[model samples]
Target: MKNITIIGGGLVGSLLAVLLARRGHKVDVYERRDDPRKAKPWEGRSINLVVSHRGWAALRLAGLEETVRKITVPVYARMTHDPEGRTNQLAYSIDHKANWSVSRGELNNRLLDEAERVPGVTLHFGHRCEDVDLDKATCTFSRKGAEPATSTGEVVLGCDGAFSAVRLKMQFGRFNYSQEYIEHDYKEISFPAGPDGTSLMDPNCLHIWPRRYYMLMGLANGNGSFTGTLFMPHKAVPEAPDAGFDVIRTEEQADRFLRTHFPDAYALIPNMTEQYMRHPQANLVVVRCSPWVHGATAALLGDAAHAIVPFYGEGMNAGFEDCHVLCKQLDKHGDNNWGAVLETYNAERVANGHAIADLSMRNFIEMRDLVADPRFLLRKKIEGHLQAKHPDRWMPLYSQVKFTDIPYVDALREGRRHDRIMEQVLAMPGIAEKWESEEVERKALELLDKA
Candidate 1:
């Protein structure tokens, strides 16, 4: 058994600790913040996450599937509400597969609890990672009102999130990294349950109000309430007209903006304006870094490796899969062979990290604008029909990403090819009225074969 040290006790770190501990490693998880179970760590920043297929596969690998499932609310479809309050529903997958909505704080706490239960696992909360010696696999941590201390292990895993200190140390090396802040910023708006504790909206479907430039999304909580997030540009550009976070400064402006663009959501959330003003407007950043591992002594995982936007809903899932991938590498090359395992892990996941980052950005466009477009809706119909007819040959890109464990790099490439093929299929005369017709299907299949 190897002595492994993990920095950050968040979702990915805690999950990695569990996986490593199960493999008989003496795992030490050092968290910067206080124990979240004692206090709500994500109280103000309550971003709800959806665990898709890859996330579940990782959890199953750690034998925590049933435990995590208890806290997730199944989301099978998306319910889009237009400005006029007219609603449309689209199933996420044709086979009735569902993604799970989980509160980030709750999930993390549960995983932390599970991690502590492992015999050789120890969790050190309130111990912030300060520095690292990459060559020696040693970390220095500091606590409030306490002297700094250093710990050494066989290997150090940096799961410390986007602004990781371990990653900071690695940045001094020949590493390549970039962080781009998206124009959009987000704030949470809570939707209370009905008087009887019943869901105010369709609990099984994710609720969306997609208004070209800005959008509001809601996911159900197990307690019958919903967590709604409004995403808007941080600053308005001369070419773009909709109000950005800069323009929506006052309570009156916030009220007007919510009432105008997301009237349905405004009606559902009682204190929309108050919550909008009270909650912090958090920016969305995408971080890309190469050479995720350093000489087998230390490596990065989860958000530390590649922090993508939340549009694709695969951020946490991708991070969880990182742990699963590393575990698989260890199994393949034996636990003691850290050199071979870390090198292979870096090679295998770096490109995938980049691919999922691109896919998430692409999905942001689809979710924010194309979701409400007539042509985009039509394309979804055509794609769904094609998949239904030719299950063996076709799977929609969304399904490939969310419903299966297909490599994200392959999925992104296939999605682009489907985009090209759909362009031709949609151009066929009368495709709007005859998308289900065999001729359209045959033409799509022929195009796929040709491509």
Candidate 2:
């Protein structure tokens, strides 16, 4: 068995620890923060995450599928609320498959608990990674109010998130990395349960208020409460007045904004203005880096390797898939053959990382602007009908990503092809009125055949 050092101890790191330890590797997970089980790790920022097919595959591989399921609320559809509070429900999958939502902090704590139970796993909390000796597979860590220390292992895995110190260390060598902070920023808003402990919105669906230039989303917690997030541009442009977080600086401004744009949400969330003002506004960043492995001595996983926008709801799932993929590579090449395993892992996942990043960005446009559009909704109906009629030949992009174990790169390519086919299908004469007819289906199939 190999000695492994995993940095971050967050979701990906914890899962990696469990996977490696179960294989009889001596795994050490060094985290920079206090253990969430001991404290309110996510005191002000409560980000909810959805785990889809890929995430479940990894959790099941680690023997934690049923354990994680207990804490999640199943979301089977997207409930889009209009400006006037009228709503439409769109099933996420043709077969009614669902994604599971869990609080980020809660999921991490559960994984940490599972990691701790693994025999060869050791978790070091409050230990911040400072620098890395990539060639030697060693890392230097410093904790607050404590002396700095160094640790070494046969292999080092950097699951340290987007702003990773290990990645910084690798930057000194030959490495390519890019980070783009999107124009959007997000703030969390808590939606409490009813007085009698019932969900205020449909608990089985993801609630969204799409306002064209910005949007608000809510995911249910198992405890009957919902975690809401408002995504908007950080600063308003001259062309788009009152379209950014800068426009909602004051309590009255926030109150007026919510009342005007998301009145239904405003009504559901008591003290909305107070919660909006109190929560911190966080930025969304898309990070892409190359050569995920460093000569077999070290490697990057999860957000450290690729960080995409959260619109696709695949951020955590993608990270979990990283752990699963790495473990599979180890199994294929044997744990002692670090060189071959790391090389194969990097070769396979790098393209997928880039592809999912693109897909996530594309989905952001669909979520923020297109979901409420009449034509877009019609297109969805047509696609769903086509898939229902021709299940062997057609699969919606969302289902390909969220409901199947299709490689993300292939799923993304297929999604683009579907987009092209749908463009033609939607442009057919009288398609708006005849979308449900056999003629439309036949035309779509013909176009698919041609493409």
Candidate 3:
């Protein structure tokens, strides 16, 4: 049996441990944080994550889909709001295979618990990997009180996050890497149970309050509450907006902001200030690199390799897919061709990672500004018309990309193709003129089949 070490027992790493161990590999997972089964980061801190088709398939492969279904709430659509508080509901699915809304910690704990049940999987908590000696296939870790421990393994997987120590060491040893940070900054907030002991927003929809340069989103929790996050430019407030019917500060300020900006939402978030002040605001970062694998001894996956903005709600989904792809490749290649298998895994996932990264960046604008604009709505209407008129030939970009199992790179390519077709059609004098005279529809149809 292959002995493997997985660094950083976050969601991805722990899941990887279970998957590898299930295949009869001896897997040791090293985690820096305390065990999630014991306790998690903070109370009432819900990390809003979307579990799409990719994530669902990943869980199903791990044989935990039923458990996930029991714990998750489905978000069937996006409830959008304008600055003036006018609301519009956009259905993500016509058939209602909605994305799952789950708390990050809850999901992590579930995965960890399942991983512990795997006979060959051993988890070491509060033991942080200090460095890896790739040449010797050895990993050294710093434990809480004990002397540093060392483990020798056939391979090491780095599923640590964006600021991965593994990636840092690889950089020091001369691996080409590049990263880009988008201009946007987001501060998260929460809206827990209120006076009536019921949810304020629709539990069945992912609610959004898009205010041009900023947006507020909320997802349902099992506790008859909603967890909300506010995505805005760092410039939204030099300090904090004033408190009143117009502006707000402190917990009182958060209450005021919610009541004013999202009156339909204010009732749901009781003690908004407490949720705001207590919850941590995380920064988003994107990463890319060459040679994610070093021989048969080391490789990187998940945020350690490609951390993208979460606008597309594919951060965890994409990471889960990474594990899926790796496992499939490993199954195909087997242990005899380990080197080739690892390299093929890197090559196969890198482009898809880049595709999702770009899509996530584009989605930020779609969420914060384009979703609120009249022209954007008009475009969507036209796109919807095309979908209805030519069901086989045309699908809305959103439907084609997010709701399907289409590869990320393929989805991105199709989205761009449709955009070009739309550009040509919109530049024409009239819709009928463009629809009747243009060859764009025929071309787009051909591309759709290819997509």
In candidate 2, list every pair of residues with a backbone clash. none
**Tens digits of lDDT, candidate 2, 119-165:** 99999999999989999999999989989988889899999999988
Clash tally, candidates in order: 0, 0, 5
TM-score for predicted model 1 compared with the true structure = 0.99
Error of 1 at 397 (Å): 0.4
- Model 3, runs deviating above 4 Å: 194-198, 236-259, 388-391, 427-451
Superposition error at 331 for model 2 (Å): 1.3
Any runs in candidate 1 off by more than 4 Å, and if so which? 239-242
User: Clashes in model 3: which pairs?
Assistant: 242-247, 242-248, 243-248, 249-253, 251-273
Candidate 1: Cα lDDT at 175: 96
C-alpha lDDT of residue 337 in model 2: 93
Arrange candidates, best lDDT first.
Answer: 1, 2, 3
lDDT of each: 0.92, 0.92, 0.77
Candidate 2: C-alpha lDDT: 0.92
Question: What does candidate 3's lDDT look like per residue over 206-247, in tens digits?
Answer: 889887655788888877677778765443454433422123
